[model samples]
Target: MTCFPFLFGKKVSSDVRRDPEIDEGLSGIRIKVYTYKQLKIASDNFSPANKIGEGGFGSVFKGVLKDGKVAAIKVLSTESKQGVKEFLTEINVISEIQHENLVILYGCCVEGDHRILVYNYLENNSLAQTLLAGGHSNLYFDWQTRCRICIGVARGLAFLHEEVQPHIVHRDIKASNILLDKDLTPKISDFGLAKLIPSYMSHVSTRVAGTIGYLAPEYAIRGQLTRKADIYSFGVLLVEIVSGRTNTNTRLPMGDQYILERTWELYERKELVQLVDISLNGGFNAEEACKYLKIALLCTQDTPKHRPTMSSVVKMLTAEMDVNESKITKPGLISDVMDLKIREPKKKIGLETFPSSYNASSSSDSQGTTISLAASSAATTSTFTLKHDQSM
Candidate 1:
């Protein structure tokens, strides 16, 4: 293995080819191959000042290509458990797909052991940083803008699930993965955990991976991944977008700590509109906002079969099709499944009637077990990359 240097202003050879491992991993993928030196210079030697985001896989830095196009460069950490396979997976998945709502892959750098992916930079960052981060960002998310964002994300997921030759399941669909451009148009980023399902396959049985708050009950417990898993996560994100809050906020009262649980309580009381972000301040259409919440409930039904398909969700959102409120049922709440030890309600919501059937101590397989970052407040626990087992 050839060793590469990360020092600033240090001279490096520009003639090196892609690593053999990377070449084999990205055999069929057609994308620009960026040299380590080029990226080093593009990012000002990966200066801390230029760093835009950090996650379990690696850190993302703002860079400018030779063509003068601004880019978000994701540098894979050498210490990360996500190795070359994930690096190639991200490229293979995104390079083959294109949609206005999906992040555009500019290229990648795979010289020696330095693995990096370059993407088009979005000015506003992700929904987690701006909307859910709570006043950390100056960007404002009005009701109309939030509605457009939700619809755009639905269309993108619809494209991934239906229009692609081999349907793609976005394993991780949290707020942090949803990026925003200057127009506030939502673009789904981060494809490292994406899985391609052949037309005939019902589901892919794999190790569970995803944020605790956004993970589907079936996928998290049984490890059987399908498009429905993405739908469940999307359902959680929909609520987050509507309410302008994180899925699980420990700061709130125990009963309202989980967004899905709280949404259900409000739904039963015939006041779903109350779940909308108060920041909207009477500007949003109450009926429309409530409709979106109902659609979210439909997507998050306890039974995966009950969840509407992404295409159906798009129609529901656009008012082309009605959201069948009759079909909405209690959602599979992660907090309940994980037993976050909520203070029992004075009048326990209908939730207690349904016993925890899926509560297993741990995964049976030696594969990674789920980690609930929502349960912890450690400074190192980044909501962005808290999906996989940290011990891995």
Candidate 2:
């Protein structure tokens, strides 16, 4: 799957040990482990023509089994340099999880040096390809279908965040990771960077790992990852769904490049309707569409405390409840965050750093800060060791 790029970086936890039961329980569940040879034959020796998708870790080939079932075979590159740890994480997390909006993992092939993943073949590929890629050249989603897709993804995320035994935070929630089935139903793929968040703890700070654009500010900058980080990222994805473009656009003029900035600008001007993809051609409900956009903005508020829980988001999107716009505040719009100062700590008497728990829109100029968005709304990541001083 194209969604597998999530594993090619620093986000994955290294401490997840392989459960002895993982191999022993294989006989009880429906998961099958095919030999490398079997998959090779099914994939026609991994021919280029059968290749349906690709990403950072490897290529996905469409295959037909001897029993005549179609499948998607993901073969990890030998050069990927990933070891047994990544393979075990994917298997352990995905095998235990089952939900309709989550991709189905049929099995895996781990023979010697070869590491391969098997999943159901989705005919519609991903939202990135059909909805946001190259301006919708292949397929167009009508308004009703788009609504279903959004609600479907929310339900999936809510399951992972709440229903699972140990709550899981899907560290990476972006357009590409969302695969579409034949009926345009959205299934979230790629659990490579998933982290188990215990019910007792509120947050964990680790080295940031996620796509640059969809990253949440608190998570990206300070490594304070909570479920809110995922909420913030989902807010960005909602923008992409309504507008049919990536969150950041480097090609456009400086002022109009970032989608969040553009959306907020329109929201403030009462021109949020204009933010809808013109390609929709007035087919979507104006009032409902704007409500969706507003909800997305609310999720992306600068303060993590302000974002709604995934359960609340589902109710709002489904029309079970109304979005209270009175609490909406200016979100932390990040554009030029590339100029971060992190990791290589230097001793200082009292380094003036912004609080990790940021709520206000802007800080005083006296404090050198990384959280402030430039006029262009450019985003980059940074971190610091803080020593708060109330004396100032």
Candidate 3:
């Protein structure tokens, strides 16, 4: 058996100064401290063949531990200095929480310039790769399975938002981040963009970091984050899970391009049921499906206060509480704030084409103008950064 270091050294890097907060945070956390060599061997020298997923943060690879357990290793791109904060945040957040719907953290590696995260290897990929991306996956997602997945995701969010002390806000809640286990259970992954909200504070002010299509209007514009921001993203994911499509699809007709806009149009016309994916083949409960769509509308309302809490959303989905159509209003659609241009990709992961990731932030410059642009050319994903003029 290969011996590994279980404790972190006095200093992580010789060149970079370690933050006192990170040092204090790491000292108390109960997760295993892995070395660069052990993780490198575990991932077979980070082989390309072991890679299962890719995103702006980095790539995820499937690996086997010395004890014979399977795992997914996430290696942060060395170029992203910002990723170090995310890496530590992920370790600090997930290492303390445990839930069936939340992804499990096996351990992490932080040695020299290398940073990696280890998680239980999920058999099936994410909903974005399978359900919404379509044709690329062989898994069958009938109505019952889809319904269960939606609730499972909602429950996980509710746990984070309500049950956890100093409740957490998952700033990025999109299809690509929702992974599926062999039993088809939904596990919410990626805490890089997560923020913790203490009981006294209503919201936290920070630079915006999340995918474009799923961002809430208030958070995107004002740079103020609350649990409702996550509610908005979850609302979009809810629609995608039910409709089997991405939030933004330029290929569709102009009026039907944005899912939230189309959903609102249908709700007004009493044709909301039409938004359901045709792949269901009349197999789903029409009334329940429509109710789910309505609940989504409630979650995405323009005013943060207008949106229901995740726990209430759970009760609504489970039929424990009534969904008040009287309170449903037009969602805070992404198209209203800025125009998004979708360029044809050189390759595809699923059938539908959409932006892999989007990052925009508020600048602290004297003029209060923010100019940020980031671009990536990964085969399965790409990154697009934008400039922001809004000030909080």
Candidate 4:
């Protein structure tokens, strides 16, 4: 299978055949093969002004293709060899996936030391940029929009877990990875950390890599990841989308500092209404909102075996199946596994309804369930890698 180099008809390198990573998926797909120079021109030579997003892997720039198509170009960091691997992995996975709720890949560039992925530029960017990283936005994610996003994300996960050939486990499912289209329809992005599990294997053990707040306890502690790990992440994302806050925010009262624990606390007290974002200003449905919260709790249960599959999750969220509260157990606590530090909120927003550290003990807060937090200032970055070392 001899092919010309990207965008150039000339081919002379004999070593191209020996290197699988050089251009593994290029031969299989008919998508546009971009050259580094082409992308550079599209992105204004990777100018800082065009940069839209930055993360562990690389920086994403907003670019206009020669055909007048607007695209998002992700340029991998040259310093990190792992970034290149992630670039190839993303292409391998997302290239085959064609879903309404998944990001559309225009093409990619793998020339010299440059690695870039071109995607359809989403108008709303990401949920993180607009919602989670809140500061300024005309976008109002009302109750219906939030619900639609949840349902869309669930269907995407369902397709990956059930309908896909070998089944895909999205290790990193968070608000930042969720993009919104012009109509605000949700699309799951970033398959760099995704794991492809053959149907025969029940689970795969490897190094843990995902957002700290969304990490499943079993997966984080033992590196044993199954489809349930994605379920747990989706569960955390559900809570965030509904509450209009991140899973972990330090700028709040100790009791409410950790959203997962606070949401659980509200569930235990049968006061799940408290879990809704105050920003909604009483616009959300009480019954439906509570049901979504409960279903999320079901997904993040302590035992992965107890968690419902993504397909079932979709049916439950879409009101196709009645969620059984009796089946839910203790929710997986991320703070319990990692060193989480809580920061004090400003003095203006006093703790009113929630019991703070002062008098939380004697309060009849749902049968005397204690709310205590141990905080540490420790911080560490997250990354993904295979379990290649059998000796370790």
Candidate 5:
């Protein structure tokens, strides 16, 4: 294993191949790859002392670089489903994307079969940790700060969806994926399951990949993916942020009530304020809270088209809106609500599995066609004015 200094260092072997196309998108800086042994020493030979956290993919270790810069290194398990392609995709996507509310990918290490991603160390771990701790000392976050986080995340997503040359959809957006720095500024992380959507296409057919509770209904049930799917996930995240609770955590009361159903019930009863985190202690802006809740409800609606675009969501969050006079649209009855009593057969579709005969991939030059407008309309009780168009 070769070791290199971080500051005023001599360049090591040039075995690393540089792809000009990929390098052009980067910040005109080449990341120095660290040998496995160097990382082993920095992480104290992957000792428990340096272990920060663990997730489905792998364990994260806190390490100090030779320059004394602290970083969080995610060491992927050999058996993890996310392989080289997915890992490289995450690095390419996150590195090109620069935003205050999005986590920064410092570099990556790919030594033989070993894969690791290094990111700037965030003092505060994740929103899930804080929300799950039941208002503990380090978990304290004012309602104002939470609201700002929501706005920041919305901006980041909007940039990904609208600004990127080929729009990208973060297939897995959740509380655990949102990291916070020492200043409590929220940054969206995790892009292992993201998909790049070409500008000409309306939707992309892909495997249903995401946490169950956070997945959009259409994507989960029908294998249809779109930017609105991200909106739905963001909606779930919004409720979690406002209420300071996990969607799937049954420990909280109300008969294992999912966040969507609980929020709807509270909305109907005009007790939406009750759903807010008690930690707020009435210090949050009531009008802003209601507005965000309404936007979230719209996003979580069963129908994907009914959900607002990322740009629209950003406007609703930041622009001056007369909440007192605004009329919110109610969410449609979700299919899961009906399926709670009856189980349905799973339908597999997309590149990962056999493609569904119902639709074909749309080409850039072709005019998109509508495949199953009636089926789409009937699937959700929520109605949208937009027409369903597909092309291949």
Candidate 6:
């Protein structure tokens, strides 16, 4: 393989080769293939001053393209477990998907082993940064803005699940993966874990992989993959937006209660007010909050079948349904109570239910199981039973 230099002025093996017969998928758009050195020069050698954030895949840098356009460049690390195949898959998936609520992929450079994807630079960064990070207290989003984001994200997912010839399931749908433009509009990003579902298939079986805390109970425990899996993730993201708390926080006294559990507990007790972000200072609409919470609970229902389709979710968000006459019920957690199986040799994993300090590099066996990484503090442990409850 011929070696290529990266935007960081580092040498890397180039695995990309030209094949006249190969389909580029993105045929009409002109794409300029850049050598690593050229990208590095354009990005000012990937300076820390331009660094945005890092993820399981690789570090993302803010860079200027050769055309003098600002962009966010995701440089895939060669050592990452997500390899060339995954990189190529992300490119193929994103290239075919286009929506106002979805991030746009400007281009990519796949020379040798060095891989980089360039995207339009959103001035507002990610939803996670704007909402959760403490640095931006003065930045308050009104209820209308929040509702727009929820609807926009739902429409984007609806497009993926319904409009696309082969439905797409975004395996990773977290706050960090949702970006914001200058107008504070939400745009879904990070298609690295997306899966294309055949038109004729109802579901696909696959290994369980996703951010902790956000995985649907059925998908996490049974490895049953479906578009509803994306709905479950969207539910988690919605709750995060409403509450402004990280899904997996060790700071809470209750032993590592996943955000869903916490929200459920609060909602059941009529303490829904407590779930809203304190920063909002009770300024948000009560009806809207309750409606969104109900929608979220419905989405996070343990059974994939019980969850509403993306189309329904979008309708609910837009208030197209008769709000006054609507009757919604809490979706109960679904799992075999007797089984209550827990994957043993518990080590810390990613952003799911554990803190970053916990080791995330451990690999899981093929049984679609993972050990709990909750802290041993007695105040946090609660004995709860998994019941086969159904919700719609």
Best by lDDT: 1
Q: Which pairs of residues clash in candidate 4, taking residues 3 or more apart in a chain or in different chains? A: none
Q: Spell out the clash pairs found in candidate 2.
A: 334-378, 335-377, 335-378, 335-379, 336-378, 336-379, 337-380, 338-380
Best by TM-score: 1
RMSD per candidate (Å) reads 11.1, 10.9, 10.1, 12.3, 11.0, 9.7
For candidate 4, lDDT tens digit of each residue in 112-175? 6667789988878777666665555678888999999999999999988888866789887877
Model 1 TM-score relative to the real fold: 0.83
Question: Candidate 1 residues 1-392, lDDT tens each?
Answer: 11112112233223457668776666555567788989999999999999887655567789899999999888877775446777877776787478999999888887888988889999887787788767767988888899899999999999999988678898878777788988999899877778888879998877656656777776655667899999999999999989997776655677876789999999999989889999888889999999999999999999999999999999999999988889999998554433222122242211111000011112211112323221122222211222222221
Query: How far off is residue 254 in model 4, in Å?
Result: 1.5
* Candidate 1 wrongly placed segments (more than 4 Å): 1-15, 337-392
Pairwise lDDT winner, candidates 1 and 3:
1
lDDT of each: 0.74, 0.69, 0.73, 0.71, 0.64, 0.64
TM-score of each: 0.83, 0.80, 0.82, 0.80, 0.77, 0.76
Worst 10 residues of 3 by lDDT: 358-367
RMSD of 6: 9.7
Q: Compute the lDDT of residue 191 as modeled in candidate 6.
A: 74
Candidate 5 error regions (>4 Å): 1-31, 252-256, 321-392
Task: Candidate 2: count the clashes.
Answer: 8
lDDT of 5 by residue, 1-392 (tens): 11112222333232544334333322233465666777887788888888877644567888987778788888866675444556666765675467788888777766666777788888887676565445643767887788888988998899888887578898767776777888888888877677888789998876556554666767655567899889998998898888876664434464434667788888888888888877778888887787788788988887778788888888788864433324345554342321111123353212221111000111110111111111122263432222111111
